[model samples]
Target: MTASAVKQGQTTTGHALPILSLAVGTFGIGTGEFAMMGLLPDVARSMDASIPQCGNIVSAYAMGVVVGAPIISLASARMSRKQALILLTLWFAVTNILGTLAHSVGALEFWRFLAGLPHGTLFGGSALTAASLVAEGRRGKAVGHVFAGLTFANVVGAPLASLMGEYLSWRVAYLLVGAIALIAAFMIWRFIPRDDPRPGHSLLGELRAFGRKQIWYVLGVVMLGTGGMFCVYTYVSAALLHVTHVPLWSIPLFQGLWGVGMVVGAYVGASAIDRNPLGATIGAFIWNVVTLSLFAFALPHLWSVTIIIFLLGGTIALGPAMQMRLMAVAGDAQTMAASMNHAAFNLANALGAWVGAFVLASGFGYAATGWAGGGIAIMGLLLFLLSVRGEPRLERSTDSSVRFH
Candidate 1:
């Protein structure tokens, strides 16, 4: 397979161009996913629907992610990574544009759900492809490079798309998102050489990931531990208004600062994971505990609150290491395992928001969300400890079989 040549770093195209094409694909996905949130009010107004009603469209997309990941992974199990990436991007581009043109909320929701169907699968292909291009222990850095596009979208792509929606039309904004996806598809086709699937690829091999307990533990850690991000983030606007008392106009700036922190965290996390995946995961959780706990106390002061939010965002550093660990244990089922990572991310978002809302409804103040999120992080950490208890300090990925420790 030509992929093996690329994997060995012997291809004339090298790794940068192919990896970059994948990153652009992720950038488009992230921009469309997040920029839609900012465009919701306009969409609601155009459709004569309530903002609450429009929220279902967002939920519909997330639901698609959860439903689509596993199915797509199974279906595409034997396709070359490059082909999978291109097809997924094209699907995203078309469905997103179709959803943007829908005149009714239900129609839009249906199309948006279709648009989301490719999301997790695309990320899975991109991560695996990127990691495959590097040496064994360096996968973290390669995966991080792909994810950097998603983080950067938070900083630039979403903001620009949101601005277009605010100043022009929401339809125009989403069409631009489709354009980015289309461009990503074109770049992938032009850059990624024709290649074949790995030897002995089979759906049964992919299914084997589920039989391993470690995969479940990694997913649980992500769903619970990483969830603290959304727990605080979901309510951050409210917190800024009620506790931090920031002016409404400055809220986006604070959010942008958080995105900046994520960009930095990705790089640092990549290096940490390359050195020690286990240690990086533990350190990230510990960092989350401290920042989340401090968030409650810091709310009264603007600078302190600002710093806390950034640090909380920086906890994204946990993602790459955790994902690498999953890949390590997944054995031959790495495709399914990697695909589930983004699905768990969406689940975490829902879980965290629910927990944050629960605390608020139970008479806990906005500040209490920090503590609630902190408590969840602690639970995740404890679960991880139990998961790895009595196991070796390092997991060996020398072969394509389940690695217990």
Candidate 2:
């Protein structure tokens, strides 16, 4: 139901229900993924592991995203996008349900990795499908709307899961995440309209996309820019504990503020991208540097840290703009590049959490993670500028987007 698809009398776009369903799945994924950041302390204590040791689970999950993106994208190239989305959520559901059965840290890492396997493909397919539904210029907003479910999860789902982990059994929290993912699968199966298989996109062509340096630069921008956010966010609870000296019970409540920032960032960033993709991308990197630097300074003051966490979540603004940028330059390998986009993101997730853990293990305070994150963001902004100096910043027209039979 793209603009071109509509003009061709193939399909007209107004399928809010399908997009809603996609958002639901995104929400479930976000809840399960982000919730762990706050609940890692609980997990660490339960497994009799150190907090830094427990952070390996985050890296494990992100590694799954990195490994799974390209493999699944290639495997599903001929399948219906709708079918792929449903199966990915089902995969997430099963993994999380099984994750509750894990007894040791190794087991926890394994199940979390399985859960991560579906992460990149689901987001990639969801973004592409959402783009297919909208027109040329508005694709950024549409993708943002679909991704809003993730940001909103930070507000509601992740915080709620943190509470569940704190008060109830953390197992119960994992069980709840599984249940939500199951519901998302059902919603995807029910709401998303059927479309025939896309045949012309060759798998070899997908590989060819990798040869382009722009794609690599885009991936690097996402990885570095996003890594900074995860560096602080992955250890938010610890910061609250050691620095802010806030009540332990207040962790989840404060975590909700981060989500509010994400929700705001998504809309604001999407609007900016709709007008100027490169400019939005530039501003997003700068935003991360400022917020992360502020977070380092603000950690001791509870109120200031709270404000900065929200602003830090605003780094999510880079997501949509970067996503659209990939599709624009990918040409025939749009699907592959789109899927790899999340691969890069979770790679960032892995790198960021690992770096955060590293900084902490080296005796740096929790606040030092912010300084590290700011430095990373500066590197990302510089790399991005170097990548796009001679390239066009505009997204490709809807006419270039995939058209289904």
Candidate 3:
């Protein structure tokens, strides 16, 4: 099977099995990535580390993502997407299990970093595969379907893992993630169709995609704007406990509500991107400014903060829009661009957590993360404007080489 054949198979047969299989992989990845936030307190106790120190564990995982995406994407350039995805899933499952076996903070961080190595490559390969399976105009919705798994992980997987961590152990949470990943690997092997090797695919070609200015600008938007959300999200448990006075048992419920918001945002953003990708991207950043700005004021009231967190979760809408924009500008190097999207996001994760931690360590309140996040969102909007100013005429051309759909 070839890439075109995969697209035709989906269109003619109306079969979504391949995309559904990919979603299973993303669900596992999402759970492994975000469940650590909820497990921070438990891990801190286990490692005899401070909350800020635990934050470095999160940063460690993100650093792995930033480093692994391009290298994995380029290394696997000659392989079929199916082979790459399966190998990546296997790597993911093994590393997550290793994470469960860690005995100290340094060991745990190392395991977490190893676990993150396949995160971006899997998502990128899955996104490109998903996009290839649909009509050009429906690419955003297809990618959104894959991401829905991630959002659903937040809803079901993250909350359950958090609850298990609360009642059982943080190690148990990692074990659960590993189990899900194992299932995903099986699903992909069983359901995803094989494709022929991509012709002329090379590491050098993938690297050259970065020569485009718009790619850098789009990545900047991801690193800066998306970091704002991570700034708030990374320490959400701490804030809920210390600031909102929420009970320990209720943490999962609050996280679940945030997931619900993401689920809604995914579909809405996909539709918006299909219509106007740039508009959707800008709008999400603007919305982030509003929601994150209110986070500080809302912190004093439980009901108000709950609402704000939900809205903040909805900022995930920016993801698909930015992804579609990257696809539009990547020319033939779709896989590289797609992988770098998550790399940029985890970079945002690292940047946001570092900044948020800085403020908290300096005698600023937890709510200060909200102010920091809002400021970053403003910078993201400015970058978006700059990207728009430099938008090449070819980007707007109807040429098949540049057109996304």
Candidate 4:
């Protein structure tokens, strides 16, 4: 069935199952992606590498996301979204198991990179599928529902994986993630509705979506705005240990609190995005500036820092609005643009970590990361302004039905 046929066939209430199934897949991806942050110490010890060297593993996974999203999205453009989701989840499960079997840091990094290959594609596909299930005006909420899994991972999956890595083995964490991925694959196969392949959708048609100036601007907004959060988060464990003087057991607690904030933010952001996507994006950026900057000052007091961490996690509320913005601006190439949103996020991951590592290496201290993050958030706000300024011209040139708001 064509997209219109599928859309017309479903009632709003019927969307629940498919969206939940997609969220399950996203939960697994989120666990596998962020679990490494908490497991970095164990991984470093196991591989006889320094903490910073283990950071390379995070960068490697992010690099794969950046490289894989567009390739997988375009390559699978003509396939049914259902088929693409299944294949992607299967790839995710297998690669994570491979990660568990790696005997050396090099091998493990390679597997992590391979495991990350499906991350963006799965999210992009899930977002598109979820959006299709709902009414047009409800697309932002649909997308947010899918991303809630990622946010919830911080609450449930990442912390559990971290605890397991701490008490058992880091390898056990990967094993658990692999299990979750397998379960997600099964749920996706059982629950997600079949989407017919886009008629006449070709690589060239997808590629041409990049020709739009607004797409580039939105991508820039993602790359810059989202990097600040990753900058602070990538090194959060180190900050908790060294700066806050927290015990190992307490780290996951803070991480879980952050996750709670994310859950709240996702729901809140969904409503905000549905109202005014551009305004929500700008507001999220501004929120990032306040929280990240405050984090620097809050570091000296554990209680204060804890609150800041929770607030910082809420910055992710920006994601659904941004995703919706890309959908509106992408025109014909929805798959590539949607997938590229996560690619841009992981690129922020790499960029933030690299920049944070540099600042730490320079002896500015762990708290300096918040300062750097705050600066990056400011840059994101400026990009949002630039995009806003150009909106009128972009609106005239594109389809009138696809409103950025």
Candidate 5:
């Protein structure tokens, strides 16, 4: 379970340490990223803006990811994965530090945008790095383990960080995140293997990744499928506040439980994907459709809502499944395609938030997020089915390697 053991890929030693390190880094990032939502009232009050206006910060950050992932991934393709990760984490620390010191809403938004520039690229590169270090059949689990760091952040880091912000000051949370990023940078530099940069890995080669059709299909699946989850989750706090009648003090506890559900879902999903990736994805999507609908109905009862939230977390299994599926389909352009997966998911994040907000603004009530989410899940399912059915059959002499854009 130690970092050293994880570095050695010793399955028996628990892989816990490296996962913990990854999780710690993710914890800081998640805390800094998500705590803003909970602290919106405080941020708006301090900056003298409306709640919706402060939401512009979130949009700005997402735009950063939409712009940053491909640029960073291609620009850094020539570097070793480990070195790239370290460099990315270093930038993470700097941007977050600036975020903590911003004097105005405009300044804060700018810094938050900068802070997000490394977000998707970091996860994409880290997932690839984690996969490269593991044996076959365990690759999915390893990637899941690394991502568990982020998921755990939901359960533990975000709630605690938000509570600290609520009790103390939001600025303190950003400080903690900056410090953790620094630690992750140091750990990545020290423990990660040193390898020569790839030969002729140019930005042009990376851009060529778009030449394939399957890539677009994968992206479609990711954006639509995962968007459903975000539609509900992006508004969970609001739901609890308005419908469940949970006290502000109890909000973090519920959110933390959702995180725990994510952790369990992630590990179990990893195992399932390793066994049968395609089947697992389909099943997970279907499961999301059903559970998310049930979640909407249970929202009025606190105890039932909590359990439903945990069940809803199971939808995260889609993440690893889609990620692995993209790897299979991406061929030589694995790097950019992998990085783009996170980009696609974040796009889902933006879509889900916008749509859910629109529904709420239209007077449908807070519980509309679940219906919004379920609608998204069903759309994703249809797309997946079409993708599979539309796949062209090959002649005996022709080759078939799943190609991804």
Candidate 6:
């Protein structure tokens, strides 16, 4: 067959299956990734380590995201997106399996880092595929649908997996993740259309994304904005235990509720961005800041805290809007930008957790994290406003290519 025929075949196949496959793969990744947080205390006890020492696992994962995203996006520039995703997920599956057998904190941390290596690249590449499958006006929504899988993980996977770890063994959670990843890999291999690798694409060209100032602005906003959620989520169990005083059996309820919030947030945010990108972005930041503040006050009263947690999850709507913003400004470096979105979130994960830890370490207690989360959200809002003020380095053409009513 002619090379063009292969390319055409790949594109057609991608249209039919790659998007759903990507979503499924992301679901596995999301489950594997966040499940660790809920299982942290268990793993720490098993390894005879301190809780903070165990936090190194989370740090290791975030470090992998930070270092691996750009490198993978650039290094795989010559490969088909389909091939890249398959390889990434395979690696993800292997590392997760290895993580199940870790006997020491150091070993666990190393494997966690390895597990994280493909996260950003997978999300970015999968998103690119998802976007290509849709009409121009609907690209954000398409991408959002894929992300909804990850959000669903937060509601369903994380809570259930965490409960499993809490009652059973943390190793079981890792094993389950591995099984899910293997399934995702199979789905990708079977469903994702095989695209011919872009011949002219080069690592150097993708790395040029760093030259754009707008990219940095978007990254900054993403780091601060999304970090707000992490600041609270990372400590939610503790809050439920310490402040809300929920029974042990009901702890999963909070995690599940948080997931429910995420689902609603993703849907609302996805639809809102389809209508008004800018408004959605700014509104998400505001909602996070306000709701998080309320969350702090409500922690002492369980009913109010439940309401706040729901709202806390809802603020996740900012995720898709911010991702679409980066796509708009990223020019030809779409892969790098897409991958960097997860990197940004991982960074937020680290940042929010560290800040929350600092507050708790200082004896302020778990509820202090809400204030920190709110502060981070407010910072994100400020950054978004700055972007709106014509910061030359961060400006993208306001071309209305994808008109929304």
lDDT of each: 0.80, 0.84, 0.85, 0.85, 0.78, 0.81
Per-model TM against the reference: 0.90, 0.95, 0.95, 0.95, 0.91, 0.93
Better of 2 and 4 by TM-score: 4
Model 3: CA > 4 A from native: 1-3, 6-9, 390-399, 402-405
lDDT of 3: 0.85
Task: Give the C-alpha lDDT of model 5.
Answer: 0.78
Pairs of colliding residues, candidate 5: 1-13, 1-17, 23-149, 215-404, 215-405
lDDT score, candidate 2, position 306 = 79
Candidate 6, lDDT over the whole model: 0.81
Clash count for each candidate, listed in order shown:
0, 0, 0, 0, 5, 2
Q: Which stretches of candidate 2 lie over 4 Å from their true place?
A: 1-5, 8-13, 392-405
Model 5 earns a TM-score of 0.91
Q: Which stretches in model 6 have alpha-carbon errors above 4 Å?
A: 1-17, 391-405
- Identify the runs in model 5 with alpha carbons over 4 angstroms from their true place: 1-20, 390-405
- Kindly list the per-residue Cα lDDT of model 4 for residues 166-221, writing each as its tens digit: 99988998898989889988888888866667557867867876898878888888
Q: Clash pairs of candidate 4?
A: none
Per residue, candidate 3 scores C-alpha lDDT tens digits across 163-183 of 998889999988989989899
Evaluate residue 223 in candidate 6 and report its C-alpha lDDT on the 0 to 100 scale.
92
For candidate 6, the per-residue lDDT at 134 reads: 58
TM-score of 2: 0.95
> Per-residue lDDT tens digits of candidate 5, residues 1-405?
123434565662344455555656666667667777777767777788888888888777777777788888888888877678888888989898878787678998999889888887788777766665555557788878877877887887788877876898778877888988999888777666565677676567677768877778878998999898888888888799889988888888887888898888888888888876667778889988987888779999987898999988888888887777777766777678888888888788888889889989999987878988999999999988787674543111012243221
